[model samples]
Target: MHWKEYIKRMPLEVKQITGPLVLGEGPHWDDRVQALYFVSIHEKTIHKYNPASGEHTKTTLDGRPGFIVPVEGALDQFLVGLEREFVVLQWDGAEGSAVKFVRKIGEVDQDATKNRINDGKADPRGRIFGGTMGDEKSPGDFAQEQGSLYRVDGNITRVADKIGISNGLAWDLSAKAMYYIDSLEQNVRRYDYDVDTGDISNMRHIFNFPKNGLDGFPDGGTIDTDGNLWIAVFNNGVVIQVSPEGKLLRQIPIPAKQVTSCTFGGPNLDILFVTTSHYMNKPGEGDPQDGCTFMVTGLGVKGHPNVNFKF
Candidate 1:
C-alpha cells in the first residue's frame, strides 16, 4: 500500500513527553523496569522516563555517549558507546541517583582523531553491532569516510568499512536478514545474516531515499512484529514504516525537523517512542517541541524486545 493510504488508514496522534534537549537520540525501552532510556549526546546526559508516573530521571556521562543498551541478564548494567570507546555503566539506587563508570570493554578508533562511534544495537544472538562516523567540523564540509561498522562479542572485529555516518541497525524476525543505514549514502541496505556465528553477508541496497523529496536520509530504525521497518528520516520530521520489499507503508509526522531516532517501548511494547534534536535551531526559534521526546500512541503494532549485549 502507498504511504498516504497507510496514513489515512491509521491516523496516529503524536504527543510530547519531555522538554527540549540539545540533540536527543538513542531510545532504549527496558521492559523489566518499565522505563524508557535515551541519550542527549551533545549534552552528555542519559535520561530515564517512567510513563506510568510521568517521572523523569537524568544521568550525566563523562564523554559523548552515543548509544546505550542493557546488558544481557544484568538489571543494573548497560553497554554504552561513548565517543571513542565502549564502556560498561551501572545505574544505582531507586531515583536514578548517579551513573557509575565501569571498566572499558572496547574502543572504536584509538588512533583516528575524527572518527567516533555513532549508533548501534544488539543482535538476536546477544552481540552488540555498531558503526562510527567521521566528524564534520565546518558548514557545507563533508567529512571523510573513515568510519566502519564493528561487531562486539568476545572481541571487537571490523565487519564493514569506508562508511559515512553509520546510524541504524536492525534484524528481521527470522534472524536471517540484517538492515543497516549509512546516512551519507541516503539508502538502506540488507544483508544475509548468520545468527549462529554473528556474520553478515550478501549486502544489497533495499531503499534509496530521495534527497529532494519528502524522505531524507535514513537515520535510525526498529522492526515490528509484522516484519515492517519503522525508520526515522533525518531533516524530514517523519518516521516512515516500510515493508521488507522496501515499499512505504506508513509515515508519521514529528514536530521537529531533525527526527534522529526511534524505538518501541511501553508495557505492551505498543508505544512507538521517538527522539528529536535541535541541531541547527536556537532556543525558542523553531517548533516549541523541537527537541522533545515524542510518543505516538494507538499504532496497533507491537515491537520486538531489544536484545542485550552478551559479552
Candidate 2:
C-alpha cells in the first residue's frame, strides 16, 4: 500500500509536549520514575518532563549531549554521550538543579577531534552501543566515513567503521536481529546479533529510503513489542513504521520539518514521543513547532521498555 493510504487509515493524534529548542533529540522514557528524559544537543541541555503533572524541567551542560540513558542501579545517575566521551551524569531532575559529572566511562575518536558521538542506546544485556559522526560542514553536508560504532561494556570496542552520520539503532530479542542506520546512506541494515557476548555480524541492507520512495534519511528508531521498527526520518517530517520483513506499514506525519528521533512512553508504553530539530532554521523562519517534542497517540502498539546502562 502507498504511504498516503496508510496515513489516511491511521489518524494519529499528535500533541506538542515541550518546545522551541535548538535541536531536540534522544528521547528515553523511565518507567521507574514515570517521567521522560531528552536532550537538546546544540543548546547543551537535558530536559525532563512528567506526564502526570505536566511539569517540564531542564539543566544545562558544558558540552553537547548526544543521548541520555538511565543507569541500571543508580536511579539518580545516568550515562550520557557528551560530545566524544561517554560519561556518568548525576541530576536529580529538580528545577534549577546542577548536573554533576561522576566520571568518564570512555571516549571515542580522540584522534579525530572533529568527530562526536551522535546517537546511542543500551542493548537487552545493558551494554551501551553508541555511534559517532564526522564533522558537519553544514546542514546535510558532513565529512564522510570518518565515524564508527562502538560497544561499551566497561571497555569501548569499535564494532563498525566507515560510517557517515551514524544514526538509529534497534534490536529484536526474539529474532536476534539488530537494525542500524547510517543516515547519509539513506538505508537501514540488519545484523545478526549475539545477545550473550554483544556481538553483531552478517550485515545486510534491509530498507532503502530512496528505493522505497521515501524523502529523508533514517534517524533514531525504536521497536514495538511485535518486533516492528518505527523509524524517524530526518528532514521528512514523518515517521515510518516497517515490518520485520522490511516492508513499509505506515507513515505518520509530524508538524516539525526536522524530526530527529522518537521512542515509546506513557504508562502503558503506547505513546510515541517524537523529537524535532531547528538546526538550520533562520530567525522567524520555519514552523513555530520546529524544535518541539510531540506525543503521538492512537496507534495500536506498545514498545519495549528502554534498557539501562549496566555500568
Candidate 3:
C-alpha cells in the first residue's frame, strides 16, 4: 500500500477509558493479568483498568506514585516508584483485587521532602531504572538540576546527576543502547549502556525539540517493535515517533493538550495506551477527552513485552 493509503487506513481514533484524573501518567501493561496499570501523581492513586471488561479500580497510596512495573518471578506483585522511594505492591487476592504496600525496597533520598521519583522502566535484565525531579523545592536549596537518575536492583544507586524532569527511559532492542529524556534540556539522548552491569556512558544527543514548536516538553515514552521511540509531547496534543537515527516519522494526534505518557497494552501488545493530564488547562478549556486514558489501535506496529522488575 502507498504511504497515504496506509495512513488513511491506520485507524487513528482513540477510545477514552477513564477520565479527569489530576495528573494521569505511567501507562504499563501486564500480560499475565491482561490489565493496564497507571498512576495519578497528585491524587496519589494507582489505577488498574481491564480493557476487556471496562472495569477500572484505583488504590490510594501514601505519597505520590510515579510509575509501576510488574515484579519478576512474582505474578501477583509489582514494583512502585513512589515520590521518595521504591516499594513492592502485592495484589490482595486475584486479578481485580485491591493492592497493598508490601515493603519499601529502596529510597532515592533520605530527606524525601523535595525531590520525587518521576518516570522509569525496567531494563532487559529486570532491574528497575528511574529518575527523580525537583517537585516541592530543590534539595538543600540547590539548583533545579539536583534531580538524578537511579538504578534500583536490591539497592538504589545514583546513575547520573544534574537531571531536570527525568522522563522517558527505554533501551534499544539490542540492550546495548539506552534512550533517555530530561525535559528541562528538551533533548532525547542516547547512551552506551552496559546491560549486565546497568552502567551507562558515552552520552550523546539524539534529537532535540524545537524551542517554540510544541506547547509543552516531552514526557514519558516507549519503544516500538521497529525500534522507533514514541514520545508524548505534553502540550503539543500528540505523540511523535522518531527513528533511532533522529529522523521524524509521524505524529499521532491526541485530544488532550497535556499528554503525559504512553505504553503498549492489550493481549496482542498492539494497542497503544495513552495517559493525559488536566492540571495545565483552565476550567473549561480542556478537551472532552482530556485527562482520560486512551487506546489507539491499527497503528501497524507492536510493542515489546514489558521488562519485569528484578529483585
Name the top lDDT candidate.
Answer: 2
What does the lDDT read for residue 128 in candidate 2?
A: 91
lDDT of 3 at 135: 56
Q: Each model's C-alpha lDDT?
A: 0.84, 0.91, 0.83
Cα lDDT of model 1 by residue, 84-174, tens digit: 7988899852454778887788887766777778888999888999889887675225476778999999999999998988899889947
Residue pairs clashing in model 1 are: none
lDDT (10s digit) by residue, model 2, range 47-91: 999999999999999999999999988888999999999999999
Write down the lDDT that model 2 would get.
Answer: 0.91
What's the residue-level lDDT of 57 in candidate 2? 96
TM-score of 2: 0.95
Worst 10 residues of 2 by lDDT: 2-11
Better of 1 and 3 by lDDT: 1
275, model 2: CA deviation in Å? 0.3
Model 3 clashing-pair count: 1
As for candidate 2, its clashing pairs are: none
Task: Name the regions of candidate 3 deviating beyond 4 angstroms.
Answer: 1-10, 93-99, 137-143, 211-215
lDDT of 3 by residue, 88-195 (tens): 998642434566778888777665468888888998899988888875442223347868899888678888888978899889847478999988788888999998
RMSD of each: 3.5, 3.7, 3.4
